[model samples]
Target: MLDLDDTLFHESDFARSGFAAVGAHLENRLGVSDFASHCERLLKAGSRGRIFDQALAECGHHPTPDLIEELVDIYRSHKPSIQLPRDTVAFLEHVAGLPTALISDGPARMQRNKVVSLGLDKLIDKIVLTGEWPDGYGKPHPRAYGEVMQWSGRIGSDHVYIADNGSKDFIAPRALGWKTVQILRPGRVHDGVAPTAEHEAEFRIASLDEISLRRVLAGSR
Candidate 1:
């Protein structure tokens, strides 16, 4: 299994595309020519929380509730120009024919937009999402792992999860006995951070290129 964000494509790339979409949306509707500065501010803030409100206030707009909702919808649903990194593409191909699944955390729409943009649905065998699961169980929640188990019909040693954010991504999978590996790509936002012992993966690697050394999945050795 895989985590979608930094594990495949960098979230920062998505953020840049979304910010440009936001800038274009603002320019088309609100006559703002210099939204790039506001975009930079939100990037520094990270997570893009309340970014529409921030940009609107900067533009002297009152940020009415309806307007904020509209802009937020635009930002989250934007079809981003992003793709799996080259090495990631090669790694996925190498793992082809495995019962590979994608288990990720995010709102259904936002994450699905990414999958669609990257054509990941064509690559992954199955997908599990917090929002799509019962009671909306995100990562670090065992139920999320359970969903992957159900979808792929694999358990414990039969499953392998490769994710980037060790802080939360490995917790449930490790607890559920799924082999876990962490891939910290260079230039990624979460690069250099160590996972807590509670979340530490069995193997920690710098990039997909290192994955060949760790391939213990059923006869792939």
Candidate 2:
């Protein structure tokens, strides 16, 4: 299995794409210029959860809840301009014969758009967007991982999950006895380190280029 976002592609790329889309919407509807740049600046400065509001403020606009909500909708629903890295494409090809699955967490529509934009439906056998589940069923919950097991009829070390986001990505899979590998792609959003050992992946590599089916299967055994 695999994770989306920074695992297959840079999350920042998606952010920039969404920002541009939202910025274009603002320019068309509210006459705001450079909104995307303002959002990118705020993100680089470590701002989270309120980039839109802060960016609007920086653009000299009094951002109201309604306006912020509208901008967020635009950001999430826009067609993302994102693609898998060359190495990621190679890695997928190397594992083409394996039963591959993608498990991701986020708004369903946004994540679905990303999958389509990345053309993953043609590459992966199963794609699980955890957001489609009821609340509290996202990563670290084991629901998605268990679903993968059921789908592939594999259990324990028979399953290997490759993902970023060490904070929560490994928790459920690790507990389920699945081998986990954390890929620390350059420019990835996650720190690739968990707050505790229990949350960290069993193995870590700097890139997907380092991975191979033989190596992971042997290590899992």
Candidate 3:
């Protein structure tokens, strides 16, 4: 189980929630109208150290470790209305008998808040956070899957990873021999990269509750 944002929770009026907080913080400090652009670049560049230093230099503020840490703290403090999704809970309850895992990439505390909020800690068999170990990297990287495989004591082919993001998360897992369930949530899109003719999945599901392990692992396709 990979969390999309808050996993079971959806922030009400999510569009305007914490975006402005970060934007305002960056705009004031960086003197850039588009702080989000810089932030995106920072993250996409694998949190490049020098880019952040340059950002600080541009702001006439020397880069300090504390400043960056504070920036992350302020960002995390930006609250979103987290309302647990009933469907997610129902899915977790239904799949209680099967081995399950929650793999996510984010700060330990913040992600832990989300997991606890959803009571997922009690439900999942394993909780794998890439950030907790040296093998930390975002999805589409096999390392995250490797950690999950380690915890579950299962080979990649034995697990079915259901995720909403097709390219970033599902693609590598599919290639690594895990079955994929593409969740069609709003705002999630295929990037016009069609699945290869040779790429076949055991199943595709809209929600976690819709899949049964028997059907998924039985060579049902």
Q: RMSD to native for every prediction?
A: 3.0, 1.4, 6.6
TM-score of each: 0.85, 0.96, 0.62
lDDT of 2 by residue, 24-123 (tens): 9999999999999999988888788999999999999999999999999999999999999998999999888989999999999999999999999999
- Prediction 2 TM-score vs. true: 0.96
Error of 3 at 190 (Å): 9.3
lDDT per residue (tens digit) for residues 81-164 in model 1: 897888889988888887788888777888899998999899988877776666537777788778778877766778888888
Clashing pairs in 1: none
Ordered by TM-score, highest first, the candidates read 2, 1, 3
Best-fitting candidate, measured by TM-score?
2
Error of 3 at 50 (Å): 20
How much lDDT does each candidate structure score? 0.78, 0.90, 0.60
Question: How many Å off is the CA of 218 in candidate 2?
Answer: 2.3
lDDT of 2: 0.90
lDDT measured at residue 184 in model 2 versus the true structure, 0 to 100: 90
